[model samples]
Target: MVLGRGNFSRSVAFRWIVSYAVILLIPVALSVIVYSQTREIVEYEIKRASVAMLKQVKYIVDGELRQTENLAAQLTVHPDVRHFLDLKAETGASAYHIYRTEQQLKKMLAANDFLKDIYIYSNALDSVLSGETYASARMFYEMKNQTGTFAYEDWRELMIADHAGQYVQLPVKNKEKKENTPSYIRSFPAQAGSGAAGTLLIPLNAEKIKTMLENIDWVKKGQVFIVDPNGQILFQNSENVEALSATYRKWIGRGTSTFTDTFQGKKSMITIESSDTSGWSYVSVFPVDVFWERARAVRTLNVLGLALCIGIGGLLIYYFARKNYDPVKELVNVFSLRQRQGTSRDLDEYTYIRRNVLETIRERDDMKNRHVRQLRVLQSYYLSRLMKGQTDRNVPLAEAAMTHHLSWTSDRFAVLLFYIDSDEGGTTDLPLSQFIVSNIVKDSVEGRHAIDFTDVDGTLGAVVNVAPGRADCWKDEIEDALAQAYEFITARYKLRFTTVGSDLQTGLDGVHQAFLQALEAQEYRMVLGEDALIWYGNVKPSEGSYFFTVNDEMILLNLLKADEFEKAKGMIDQIVQRAFQRQTPLEMAKCVLLDVATTLIKSIPGPEQAGVAWEEWRPLKRLLSCATKAEFHQELHDIFDKVCGVLRSRQTAHAGAGIGDQVAEFVKENYRDPNLSVSMIGDRFRLTPQYVSRLFREQIGQGLHDFISQTRVEAAKALLQTGASIDDTAARVGFASGHAFIRVFKKYVGITPGKYKALQ
Candidate 1:
């Protein structure tokens, strides 16, 4: 059991798995924390949104109430009304003088939308005047009977009494529509302790206030209420108003504007917007499940998203960890001395691996020169493959590393690369020359770092294990050693060799990465001069490569298809120029240029439709062969020029044959849209408005706007003949109002819509 436990605990694979599982829990914990913190924010936003909407209702209703109160005060002290109530009128009220007061009342009633009717009482005359005419108490009561209750057996007693009370809502009918009208009463003779000269009564149109509430910006499923200053519910939309009325009254001025409370066994969110002018409150109550469901949905989505991420992230972590663990597993299988020579179980995994690798190295060094040469060839080929992938599978790094006596226990590694840049004419192809160069490089840096050598494509690569406790200044030390090797090789052999180095990286996989960066930096030799040493990572720190994105691909294709070849080519020019100016390696530059070339080829419609010949095969292969930046840019431009010609023809073909008919058909189908004008059609077909209008006129034998107007008016004729009202017909045909519809209908049909409908 102790031996088994030691093997398990020392496993690198086990640690990786534990680390992967631990990493996946980060997002899970973050999702929980984010959901808890954001729920309160969501509820506050809901309250703030509700309050903002209700405030508009409050403003409109409050303004109406204040204006009505002011109007009532004005009517009370009016000259005609005061003359009728004068105590010095010895012969009592004159009929003609009272006629003016009745006319004023009628005008006020007609102007105000909220007033259903108005009544004025005079104690001196012992008569009540109303909006219409002088009427007896029986006649006035019958006209406004349902609106309010009057406790007057005689007019003098009724006029001198104060009728301060809540507003009353009564049903008022007009044709088939029945709406409620609420009544408000105010006393005149504005004295503290004096007899009331009369009373002014106004029956407010509650339907108008409800209409104001209905115009609230955001519609929430809720009950709306209008409460007066006295806490009386003037109007409510709930079916069980009596049940919720006490709750509404209790929650008012509860020191908080919005809160959740249960009413009639259902929890509700109450939002209150109080009016400043009249002290009236605009209140909305909605079921929590109905109104704030978005908050709950957010929390639910967060949980589901967290679960989904854990599932996906767990699989991804395991796949990567298992894949990365291949090297260690292969190493144990290949060179486990404990398994091969039956060593003691007391030896742990690392100690067993180190002993096996050291014994193998001893055996390799004892081999003959022929065997050594063959081994070098195999190591060179396999290590060269590492230049292409992070971990090359051609030869397992574990076996190659053990056989080559490469460092197996180091924490950091980097690359030192050198190449014969003076052979720009491609003259040198000597195998012995690369062999000599590799030996000199390995000899110079061998003592300072553990080194392994690989030679491919005439470039010598040295993989170095950074010395322990030397990670911070490893770059400077390695570069200094490489500088000495470059000088010795060039001065002695007249070979202008440029050196490249990579930043120190971690793990066995990092050796592969170090090889890749060295190769990428090799491409920048001609751009930065043949003698310059380059670091791929430090090319441009502040500005990253300006590579083409998905949006750029779409824009380039759109411009090409529209025959905006000038703009498309300009975009390509910008992409290439900006990427080069940013001083990145040719990898990003190649990818960006290849993408632009592909999009340009895709923009060419087709062979038969393009009326020309073009080939998409081997296009990118040609791009990759360009040796220098100038040659690469020129090749991409050549492709652009060819595709541009095909696109111009495509654009011309679309404009020449049936474009007019297409525009005319589109207008006929969408003439009901008020925004369907020349510019909209031009944008749809990628033509100027003038060009589209002229083509439409030539094909359809009418101006574009005139045809649209005629089509709408023709449709209006059918609706009008069906007894649909003029305004409804106008709106149905997309006219802003009946007036614009009538004007256009007359211009097209040689008569107004009304006249045309009558004739139809």
Candidate 2:
């Protein structure tokens, strides 16, 4: 009977424990799942809201950029602007012209409060005229010295970087006023001619950018920055600008992207938006915890409830087991003693429950660890895609990263690169060498720096997550770590590794840009040599003047005239090499080479030998469509070789025809039409105007002008004899004005047009 009662109590205890566990776990699990979903929803909504606000900010910033571009375009077409830029006179007219042009520019400045000042850079005058003040020659030169020719060269680079894009230079302190001015530059004439007209600079109001960014309260809670195509931080409205800018370097070309990552040891979210016009990116950063703080309370309550349920369930199981097992007490004690011999038997009844609980916790933790590992792998792949500028479906990527437990939304990033020199000659095994390098770098920077190193081919690329307030010394820290790595690798393997790193960027979007910049810095290894940590700040844009000088043409002509074909070829190569070295616009380089070709043609025996025919050459035609420096250089060589062959054979004899007679015949046949000028004649005959005029006068014993005038008067006299009106005669004979025609007719015939007509 006692045994039967023990069995009944044992059954009751087992049922109660199972029932209580079911009652407790259901609510806790549901709460956990619900909380996780809620947190995700909240983050998604915040990202959407932030993106919408960023687009609005982008709209405002892009609108301002467009307005500035339109203003520049309008100024390019302004009558006074055209007149001032196209000025050819070097004497008395420039002062009045400069004054008038300045007045017009000043009026433009007055019309727009955003325009602080204007600079008109006249390449023809070799002067940069100011609209803000009445600048004399001395003042202009002084200003040029202060501003530097590098500024002008940079503008040219800007034009080349994007033909349709306007350039906005970073903030600079105004010399006259103790305030910052951000210069907006746009060159006149979208395409350059033989000579450039000038560049126009409008210093915009920087405060406007600040105001627009300030209105983005969500992003501004962390920081906001505008980055240009060249990776320049144009404007920022944050106390930690250095930190923010460092982060922005990573988001350079990211059109639209968002991710959650850590900043300053605190979790954060970052969003980026790019402008269609200027290619400037707008970046917004916000703390992550701020968006999910409410979910923490729900999780805490669920945890407490789950612990209470387990505690209550365990007590009931113990109570019922003791009450039900009274009859089987001896049997239970024997089993307990045997179990104690094998394991810990001091707390026998509850041991089974404890073992089961421990098993459940271990399984949960194991699953979590696996998920985190999977998330890291996904994050690595996403980072690669981001660096490659493939964030078109960024929302999905972010979701995948979040699900895997990887934070895709980092507010700041830095790319660290390790380039193993091909000629270092330490190891033939590339993978092993790369692995060793990565390990060394990782070991040196693992805990203190949050960075991921990936093998990008032979180069080991490290994409670092920059903590906030760390921008100032990030470079120093990176350099120090790299130095240590470098020493460690060299001492162990004797392999030389060159390290390069980009500036701190605002988001993962900048990772690709930073990598590119780091690569660019690596290229400078040709100039800077090896074993040095080359930073983005060390590599500068080419600042040399890109113009082909008169002396360069003279040297080429002298070589061609001397029939030194090899020397001429070398000279051609030099010209190409120098142009590319200076980073000259390919268009400008083409113009220079064509100019050289023209010089070669003119330097030949006579005009007809090289005239009209030169323009129709197949090589010249091919030159017009050539896209690269190599193709252009080859075309130049082909032209040079053909010219050299013609010189060698003396085949350019032109059938013994004299150029002066040809010019006379041409003028006699075409003089009746208007638009006839010395310059036009020179173009038709492939000769300089001065050269053509002097040759014609030498052959005809009078100036080409006198001969053309005499021919026109003779034609007008015949027309008058036919009873045509004075205006009709003037129009027929290519005279622009009837009064001028009448005067010329009277001067030649020694009478008025009517009297001359009656005599005829």
Cα-based TM-score, every candidate: 0.34, 0.33
* Per-model RMSD to reference: 26.3, 31.9
Q: Over all chains combined, what TM-score does candidate 2 have?
A: 0.33
Alpha-carbon shift of residue 415 in model 2 (angstroms): 97
| Model 1: lDDT of residue 592 | 79
Q: Give the per-residue lDDT digits (tens) of candidate 1, residues 1-760.
A: 0236557766666777788888888889988898978757766776776777677667777778887888876876788877665633367567787888889888888899787678776655555788777765556554544333333344335446776533444444445455455666667674345677667777787666666665665543677787765567777654355633664687776623888877656887778877766566777776666545777788889989998998898899889978987776677666553466567656655576787788878887777666878877776776666554545445654575787655644658777677664444432655656666778877887777777777756667777787778777767776777678778877776566677767677766776777777776666766555676777666533446456888889999887765566787788888877666536545677777888877877776565333432344356778878776677778888888877776655555666567778877787798778777878888998786666777677777778878778778888888999999899998888788889998888887788878777777
For TM-score, the strongest prediction is 1
lDDT tens digits, residues 1-760, model 2?
A: 1125444434434555566667667776776687668877778977887788778888877776677788888888888888777775465346787788888877877877666667776655545666766454345534532343335455434433323335655334555534434567766763345544677767777776777677766755676777767676677876465644455466655557997766666676778887878777887777777766755776677678777867886687667656765644444455544342345333333444455457669999999999877876676666666666686544553464465454334467777777785445577587788778877787887656667766665567888876567778777787788889888788778788878777777654677788787776665554344677877665545455646789878888877765556788887788777654423444466677777667666655676455633655655567777665567777787777767777766633432247778888888898887888888888888655775787787777778887788889988888898999989999999998989898888888799888888877
User: How well does candidate 1 match the true structure in TM-score terms?
Assistant: 0.34
Q: Where does the lowest 10-residue lDDT sum fall in candidate 2?
A: 156-165
Which stretches of candidate 1 lie above 4 Å from their native place? Answer: 1-32, 87-92, 146-150, 153-158, 162-182, 190-194, 215-220, 228-231, 243-248, 253-256, 273-276, 279-281, 303-760
Give the worst 10-residue stretch by lDDT in candidate 1: 146-155
CA error at residue 706 for candidate 2, angstroms: 52
Clashes of 2: 17
Cα misplacement distance, residue 598 of candidate 1 (Å): 99
